[model samples]
Target chain A: MRSTKPRRWGERLIEGAIKSTGIATIVFVLLIFVFLLKDSLPLFGHAKQTASLLGTRWLPTSEPEQFGLIPLLLGSLYVTLGAMVISVPLGVACAIFIAELAPQWLRELLKPLVELLAAVPSVVFGALGVLLLGPWFAKTLHLPVGQFAALGSLLLAFMAIPTIVSVSEDALHAVPRALRAGSLALGATHWQSITRVVLPTARSGLIAAGLLGLGRAIGETMTVLMVTGNAAVIPQGLKGFILPVRTMTATIAAEMGETAHNSTHYFALFFIGLLLFLITLVVNVVAEVVVHRMGREAK
Target chain B: MSALPSAVGRTLTQTGEDGSQSAGQSVAEEAFLPTCEEVPCAPNILRPEGEIKLEARSLNMYYGSFQALRNVSMAIPERRITALIGPSGCGKSSFLRCFNRMNDMIDGFRLEGDVLLEGNDIYRRDLDLAYLRKRVGMVFQAPNPFPMSIYDNIAYGPRLHGRPDRSELDQIVEQSLRQAALWDEVKDKLRQSALGLSGGQQQRLCIARVLAVQPEVLLMDEPASALDPTATFHIEELMLQLMEHYTIVIVTHNMYQASRVSQYTGFFLMGELVEFGHTEQIFETPRDKRTDDYIRGRFG
Candidate 1:
């Protein structure tokens, strides 16, 4: 009798599918990079366009309009950093409370509620900021009562909290039970055990959580648009800061519809979009690195 | 030679806070207090050897609705090997853990009775259990070394409770290892991961680790159960040497091991003690019929 060999048809299909996915991911990333470069070709390489960022006040409708993105760049950083200042500590505390201290029933109820914050639409958060936070800060601080960077930061912080809490709670839970038991047996109190054992063990995971929140905060658009004064100028003070400071995302969203075809105003918004995509990409890489380091340390 | 079993019974009662004494009874093992009245003691059970280190009086242990020990009373003398031997589920290991209040770590564990350690009511509310455990250490049946190096394993107990001086710690670690008969074998590889040690070596390291805490009464719950024959003999030899300086209460499933290592032996059956006496008398001339049957291999 002849021996029958295996065909592995199913295995080949799986392999092909995996390879296709890998190729698709790379191609998708390449397409974004190439498109951004193609859109910004004028500023970097278009000699005939006669780009003069210094003199022009960015009236893209004029024959020779400027597309200086320095204001948008400054705006993006200001809002992202401001949001981070508010959210990092608040999010971390919320995660710790949910993971370690809250009672079972309370944590069960509270965790899902906090998670719902993440599920809420960015547009809704923007509307809430415009209706609530923007004016509230404006009145309380006695500044120009308009949408501002402060409002954008407030909305962004609220939005970022859920991602940070969910990821960090999981990180804290990932700490080994034995380590906790060992610390307790050694006569360490529960607080000490959490601080010395659990927190240290979960440090990397928490850092990853922060990085993920940062990525989301930096990429957010609508909330910043609706509440932020949407002024393209850099903020002057805390009160004026609550007025919307135009972000890279907002620049693209607000200007794209009215931007003249083949104009520097249009290309500048594309440049800002490209910058955001890179910022998010870098944030993802950092988050991955922190999480990998945590896995390595856990062993 | 003095027997000082630390942290037994009443000394650890302070841990009863947060409704743990009654509510925590689930983790409280019932196999500890067998109805000791059924067991006949050696005519000399009351013939106090030298200094009495540990004593259990009218101890009753239960697991929820199930009673594990009934009015169990026993005494362990100083610097002597007292072995509690019985078949599976006989409450030997439970009794061993009682000496160190280790059962407190188990959830729902509660003990109803007095355990005296050197004339002190160990179960009293004011007693500090963490400090008491320092004086009465334990070795578990399975070798459970902390995930650390061999040196750290031995040094952990001393380093805790304010022994921070490096040289003093080194001296304590070495002395304890020598007491456990493991200094020579592990001296060169002190920094290696304890999890990398051979089974017997790890057992000895655990012994050394417990000894470093400077416990006077050593509670071993089948220390050799997981070791090879050679390791078993070495542990037996160590026990003999240790008996000269410490009161030892060992729980073993192996009968011959009980006979060979311990001077005093007790047999437990179904939450009740069947016999306890001199090793020779219990094995050769048992007062109770159950003892005879057990020794004769009659379906223990």
Candidate 2:
């Protein structure tokens, strides 16, 4: 009993430390949510001014300033949709190749290299977009300026690929080897088996991967800001892709420093931040649900 | 049982030259014809009336530098249950996977010699894998029904080969479930997820899924090993019933199961066939010392 006393004390100390750490994390998250809410609430008091802020234009510096988030929201939507279009198919296919088709040595070599892609800073991606892609798109596509939503999308898609590939590959790898053998033994060809059995089995994980990529792409500010030619205009249909656009994160990052503290513009920026947070929260929750369901189905 | 033998005979005959010649047969050399040769201590397990459905001649299997099966040879009689009994890791499972070329999925799985199904070498370059596997279905040690409804699970194989009429698929699903003795338990819930079934029912569902393809041979690797005693008894009875319609090759660790379900039994040890004979004779009067020792619980 005496010897067990010291062991019990040690265990209590460890348990207390872990419990405090968990509480600290939750407190920090709640604190941030409160701070965002407090900053964003002042806009509601100036109803007339805030109401106009929901209109089409977003000239924050102009006298009788407009703070309509439609253009910014549209800009974010366009870039994110475009990024998913480019990345989802490419990422899922690359994942399948790495997980199923690649030779043993090649798969080993590629996994670390692909993970290395995630370690490259977002700023570095911005630099590459500015130096290489911007000039090429401007000249080749005959645009007035190279920086546009399309350029932002291309860079953002590149940034999202590592997340999608790694996550989806892990999902594919989780499928039981027995399922593949059973499919093949049923007289299905390799391609048939992969499509019919393996892909469907990994569907939830694949969806979660795409959602995670979307969250990453939407939350990314530096890459889109540097490349998207920050012209705060509601872009026209189809032609808008090649034209300059400014995303919500870019607006917050570019203007938050310049805006007067606690002013309507400042409050609106926090509101945008809140919106961004909510979008990310929803996407993350969905991803978690999908991944959780996938774990359950695996049984 | 009476109707089963003729149905299985027709299907097994369908795997022969006349049965498959009409389908795409990527023409190859008319050479390398090999027959089942006599091996010492082989107890003439081939019943007089049963036909040879599959034959493995001088088969040597290797995974890189490691040899898994060495010069193993055997004949699988049509419409009968042949049990491969051995202790763990004795190559019984490896030999069973050879029938449908399921080992081809493994990297560095190299094989020398031939595995003939209905007198055609399965390893021939010109053979279509889809066609070959369709005729030879497999049930794993663990139940592996797809993450779909019970109806869809059975329909997966039939749908893969070609799109059948919806009504025809419905009939096939029902027939397969009945064959596996799972129709009554699952008929009302055919649309429900197959994952909801009990472990025993899931294994039977897997068997039904394989049967949906109308396979001529069924390769079972410890089909009842994962089940409880009652489930094991049910599966044993199911296998006996299935034997009338399919050439069943089962790998089991249960000596009693081998005796109960199989007419022919092959005793394996250290990747070699020590004896192949009728189940009763092998159990009652094993010719080889190793066979006798194993049956008498002397050693694995």
Candidate 3:
């Protein structure tokens, strides 16, 4: 008993450390939610002002100061939808090639290279969007200004590809080898087996992958703020992709310092933050549910 | 049991080349053939019979540096059950996989000499793998049903070869399940997921899936080893019924099963075919000492 005492003490210390860290993550998320709710609650008291904030315009500095969120909401929607359109098909195809078709040596080389893409700083992507893509789009598309919603969308798509590829690749790899053998022994070609058997088996995981990528694209602020010209106009249609616009994230990031403390604008920014947090939470929860169901079905 | 031989004979003659063929020629072949009448009791000896459905000529198999089979040669007869039995790692399963070239998927697997299906070299460079597999289906030891509807599981094979219309698919599914003796239990629940079935039913569903492709031969790798006793009996009975049409090559560790179900039996030991003969002769009469020892339970 005496000899085991020191080892038992060390085990208790390590267990306590792990438990504290796990609890710390939950406590931190709750603290942020409480802070956002406390700050945003004040804006709901001014009923007329709050009602005006839902109208078409967002002229924050004009007479009486409008704060319509329609343009900002639409801008975020357009950018995220554009990014998903570009990333989902490309990322899924890349993942299939890596998981099913690549030779062993090539697979080994490509997996780490894809993971390294996530390590590149978001600021670097923002800088590239500002210095390179913005000017290129302006010149080629005949736009008056280089910074626009399309430029931000393109940069955000590039940023989201690594997440989509890695997650979906893991999903594809999770399909059992026995299913492939069964298909092949039935005289199905390799491509047929992959498309019909493996892809259907891994469907939920693939959906989870796409949703996580959407969360990443929607939450990204730096690249959109740098490239999207911060115009507070509601875009009209598909043609609005080339027009200047501002996302909710970019609006909060670009204007928070300028607003006075405890003002309507300040509380409105917090309200947008709360909305962003809720959207991200919902997407993450859905992805988690899908992944859990996939694990259960695989068994 | 008394009526089975004539019924099997009538089916064989109905599917034979022509009535104009000389009776003497067929009798010469039947001298070697083990009739269904002989299934219940041992005969003196039986020789190679009828047409050779699958032939392995001086074949050698290797996985990288280790040799799995060496200079193995055997001719499996048409419309019969041939059981390959040995202790584990005797290369029976390896030899069975060579029929459909399933070993091709293993990394560094290499084969020497030729494996022939219906007298055509299966390993020829121009041979289409899809067509070959369609003609020679496999049932693995463990049941592997796709996580789909039972109807879809049976329809998957036919859909791969051609786009069968919905009515044609339904017909094929029903016919295959009936052939596998699983139709009565699953007829109403064809749309239910195949994964919900018991282990034996899942195995039968796998067999039905393979049959939907209309293969000429079925390669069974210990097909009933994973089932309970009643399920094993059902599978053995199904194999006996199926031998009236399809040529079956089964690998088994059970000596009594080989004796009970197979018409011809081959004893394999350490990558070589030690003896091959009528199942009755191999069990009752001892030629090679190893064969005698193995059947008498002296040593594997």
Candidate 4:
């Protein structure tokens, strides 16, 4: 009885430790948000400068230092959208091939290899983008500067593909086998069954996968910073993909070290950080909700 | 041992004629017949009155090295309810799946001999699987309604074969659901998800889904096994109604269900067709001891 009591005490201590750590993680996240808000709140004291923050130009070092956010916001959007365009189709196709078409031996071989892609350091992808993809783009597209939004997008797409493939593959696999059999038994061809039934059934999860990939692409700083030429200019139309652009993440990373602490520029960088954090949080939350819906529907 | 002398003689003569050309045919005949020396071969009984819609000729099925079905042959009549009853793992469901080639999806599954549909060898290499499945539609044990609108679930099959106009789809969906006796229940909410339907309605919707494809034969693998008693009764009644138009083959574990719905019942044991005869005769006067034992609640 005494021994059991000591074991029970130990178990309670472990449980308490786990519970506190979980609460602590949430508290830390809230604290980070608070810190960001605290630093960025100083910009609101200068109403005119704060209003200029929403202007089209982002010439932070020019006379009076215009801090327009449109160029950077649009730049991030262009690169993220470009990455999604390249990765979503490729990742979904790869996932379908892995989940449905690949034989046991091939699936086992490919699944781990795809997951191994995730382990490759982001800095390595950045280095590769700078050294290889940029020069190749310059040569092929007849561009004077190879570093552009497309170059960063291509690199970010490669980074996001692993997450997209793995998550989407799991979603596809989660579709009940009975649904496939029902489709097959109803005279649908194998390809028809996959496209008509399985894909639709896993639709929400697929969306979640795409959103996760988007989040990864949007937040990627190193690769885009290295490849996008760090040009804080508003890119023009569909042609913007080939033009050098700057993402919000890249701007914050490049300027935070140079800006004087407690200055308006520094506060603007913190505000951009908060924007990035909020955008990613929203993307992740939406993805989580979609995944939960998928789970319910699967049941 | 030989109370039915006339039946035994007739069976032997029939087997002789059927087995004259093929060595494999004779082997299959011998395997089932020789073991029941005390009783007449059950297949020689008063045959059902319709033309054969599906037939398995000396069918042997194997999954890798493990045999799931031995040499088994049976004939299913057109527009009739034929029930295959056996205990778990007795190859009854496997036999049902063979009609529609549903077992083809399983890895390492190998089949010898032939399954014929309307006198055409369904197992032929060049046979269009989609067409075969269209002609021989199946309902699984659990009600599997696609997670879409009830109307879309019924329309799915018609749309797959061809691009039907929206009006044409609406017509097909209505006709199919009506035929399955489900239209009235869901007529008001055609756009509602099929997953919203009750267990019984979902099953009937599955039936309607198959019927939408306009199949000649319906293979049901314990269609009501997952439903409540009331739902099972509804399914049974629906099966009876469907028998007027579709040749139905049902695999079931419930003995009473087989006796109630099927005109012809085939009893399977350890992957062999132990006895196949009129449902009345099999339940009342089974030719083989195994069939008699199973009917009387003995070891399955």
Candidate 5:
């Protein structure tokens, strides 16, 4: 009875420590939200400043400093959409190959390599984008400068691929072997079974994986700041992908260092930060809901 | 021991009009029964009933360095249920998978011998795999209904082979569901997800899915081992009814189930075909002492 008391106390101590860590994480996120809102609240105090903030351009340091949200918002959207366009098909195909087609030895070898890609620092990716890819695009596409949105999209897609491949491969691997065997037994070829049974069953997880990649791509700063030729303008349609554009992350990152500490420009940058945070929060929420639904259905 | 005047001979007298037996080709089969040497050869009581649908001639299977099946050879009678019974890991399921070459999916799997289906060697390199699987469908131990609607699940096989007209597909779906005895229960809810069905219904749906392809041979690997008693009974009854159209090869661990549904029974042990005979004789008067011990529940 005395020995049981000590063991129970030890277990209770460990449980309390775990529960406190969970609460501490929530508190830390709430603190960050409060801090962002506190700094951005000054932009809403005056009608003139609010009007200038929503104007057509983001000329923060010039006379009549206009802070149009359109160009920055559109720039981020273009980069994200282009990145998804490049990453989804390639990521999903690579995942399917890793999960279903690769032999055991090759699978073991490739899986760790894919994870190693994710572990690479973002700054290294930025350096590669600036040094190697920038010049290649300029020569190949005959553009005046290689630092365009397409280059940023290509680099971000490279960064997002590892996440997409690993998560979607896990999803495909989670599909039951019995389902594959059943499909094959019914006269369907191997490829037919993979497309018709395994892929469909893992559809929700794949979507969640894609959303996670989008979250990663949209929030990236250094890689895009270096390569996207940060020009604040509303880019045109398909032609705009090859033109210079400035994203939300790059905008705040470029201006925050030079802006006055208590200036309206500083407050506007905080507002952009808040917007970026909200977008990522919404994306992560949707991803969590999808992954949780997939887990339930799997049960 | 002598043959106790085969019961299959008596059933031939009252055979139904649905082409039960090829009129007395039995004289030739009985002649071959006496020359048994190494293995205890019984007169293959089901031989009078139907032609041999599948024959495994000295099949040996290996997985990497492990031998999973020995010199296993048997002839499965057409339009009848043949059950392979053994303890766990005895390779009954492996042997059942040989008919449709399902084991080809496994890595390091090697087979040295011929598995003949209707006199054609299925292991030949030139055979069309999709067509081979179409002729020989399978049902797994666990119910694995596709993650789609019940109607789509049944239509999957036919749609893969050829794009039938919509009306033709509907007819095929209805006919298959009815044949599996699940049409009435799922008729109103054909659009519902197959995963929403009960375990027994899902298994029946899988059976219907296989039946939609109109396969000539059906391989069931412990089809009812995961079901309740009522569900198992339903599956047994379904197998019996299905015997009129499709030949069945089942792998099971249940002695009673083998006796109840199978006309012919093959007992396997350590990847070897220990004994093969009529179900009743295997349970009552097995030729091999190991087979007798297994049936009597002395040890697995």
Candidate 6:
């Protein structure tokens, strides 16, 4: 019992370093967020931008200083709605097919391919959307230019789908085998058990997944910039729905290059960035709440 | 002969269609309905005990290269508690699962011979496995409630078949939880999350969920094995009570439990039915030496 025990100083130092690094990373993210919020305060007080968030035009720094963001807000909403409509069914169906109905060989093959979709670079997706979907929409939908809301939304759908599929597939797979067996033991068919019991159990997780996909849909930058025509006009009709629309990320990205420091327009773009940040944060928080509710429901 | 009465003769007559009735060929139909009992040279009679609701006749099962069960033929009676008593690896649990085709989930699993329910082959391709499972509900060794409210867990089954009215769904949830002896504890918290319950409560909740489906037979695979002594005793009592409506088949390694709860006891060893008879006979004077040895703590 009196035997001497020794610990390596190097090991202690290395462990300490790893913990400090993690804490530092957390602090770094918080600092950046606070800095961004501090940088975007002017848009809230500017007379010219008074109705910017509520107004239809977005031509800032012009004779009238039209800093209204309502059209941009609508444009963002329009694209996000379209992305959700496209991604939700496709993602959940693929997840169910992979996790439940796919043949063993097919599942093994498809799972990695779907997961790989998550790792593909966002900029690459944006470039491909611009090259492929933007031109096709402009030609087919009769948009004045190639980049439009429809093209951006379709690209966002592609980006968001992998997140939904992977998360939902995990949720579906997490449902206890006993529940399925219990349903089966009670004279329920395979499809019946899956649809009735399994899906209901996975509802909360599926909601979280959908919210996360929505977050990704809103936060995407380069793709929105490439496909959204960056138009300042309020769109009219189908053309409006598919017109070159300005979005939060696109406005920030396009204006940040030419914007002058201390100028209201520069702060306006920063405010837009802040708004994007808040939207994604809200989406994530909502997702967490839904997932927690699901966990409780599972219990 | 004494345990079985001649009422089963009536069931035999029902099996004969009118085509054979006019020709007095009823005895011919009796031959097709196989049995081990001698019917006094008469045909159309139903033995009260021989009315076997479910039977595993010369059943053998294999899991890949491993032989999991060999010739595990046993009869399960209606509305009675029959406990399958055996050591681990004796295939008692596997045999229990066969009642509802739960073994279908396992890969490379094969079964032989007929598993008959009401004299119908359960393994027939045409037979709907879903319907088989519905009639033969099972509880696992561990508690596994769905990720849902205690109420929704019970309501899930009825909701699946067809849309039931709101009040009807409410009544079913209450009745099923009450049937599983958990209503008093959970009635107020019916809408609360199920995972919030304790392990034994969760197990009972699972039982309640199973009961909601209105299964005619309940197969419990060491249902109380994961519970504390008090919880175990409660489940044992619940099993006895459940036998009034649902024929209960329980697999338990506890010899005392088998004798305490079962009307009939089956002793399995090395995947074979070592002895199967009335509980008193199996406990007092088993006909087979292996059964005596097993009951006396000999090698499983």
Using lDDT, give the best candidate's number: 4
Alpha-carbon DockQ of candidate 5: 0.78
Clashing pairs in 4: none
Highest-DockQ candidate: 4
lDDT of 3: 0.86
Instruction: Please write out the lDDT profile of model 4 over residues B243-267, one tens digit for every residue.
Output: 9999999999899999999988998
- i-RMS for every candidate (Å) is 3.6, 0.7, 0.5, 0.6, 0.7, 2.0
TM-scores, all models, native as reference: 0.70, 0.91, 0.89, 0.92, 0.92, 0.85
Per-residue C-alpha lDDT of model 1 across residues B1-300, encoded as one tens digit per residue = 123223333123323421343432322321222333443222212223457798876566766666666555677878999889888887767777677676665555678878889978788899887776767777777776665688887776766667468898889888988988888988898888887888898889888887877778888889899999999999999999999888898999888999999987878877666666567667776656778889889966
How displaced is residue B57 in candidate 6, in Å? 1.7
Off by over 4 Å in 5: A1-7, B1-49
Model 6 lDDT, residue B115, Cα: 88
List model 6 lDDT by residue over A1-299, tens digit each: 64376768897799899999999998997887887887888666876576665777788768767777777777788788888989999999999999899889999999889889888888888888788877776788776888778778888888899999998998898888878877777667788888888998899899999999999998888888887878867766665766778887888888888988867788778778777878888999999999888776655
- What level of docking quality does candidate 4 show? high
> Tens-digit lDDT track for model 5 on B213-296?
999999999999899999999999999999999999999999999999997889999888877766765776665778889998
lDDT string for model 5 (A264-296, tens) is 898999999999999999999999999998887
- Per-residue CA lDDT of model 3 for A150-186, tens digit only, reads 8888888878888999999989989988889999999
TM-score for predicted model 6 compared with the true structure: 0.85
* CAPRI-style grade of the A/B interface in model 2: medium
Decide which is better by lDDT, 2 or 4. 4
* lDDT score at residue B250, model 1, on the 0-100 scale: 92
Q: Which lDDT value does model 2 have at A48? A: 64
Off by over 4 Å in 1: A1-43, A47-99, A141-155, A232-246, A260-263, B1-110, B115-129, B136-160, B163-300
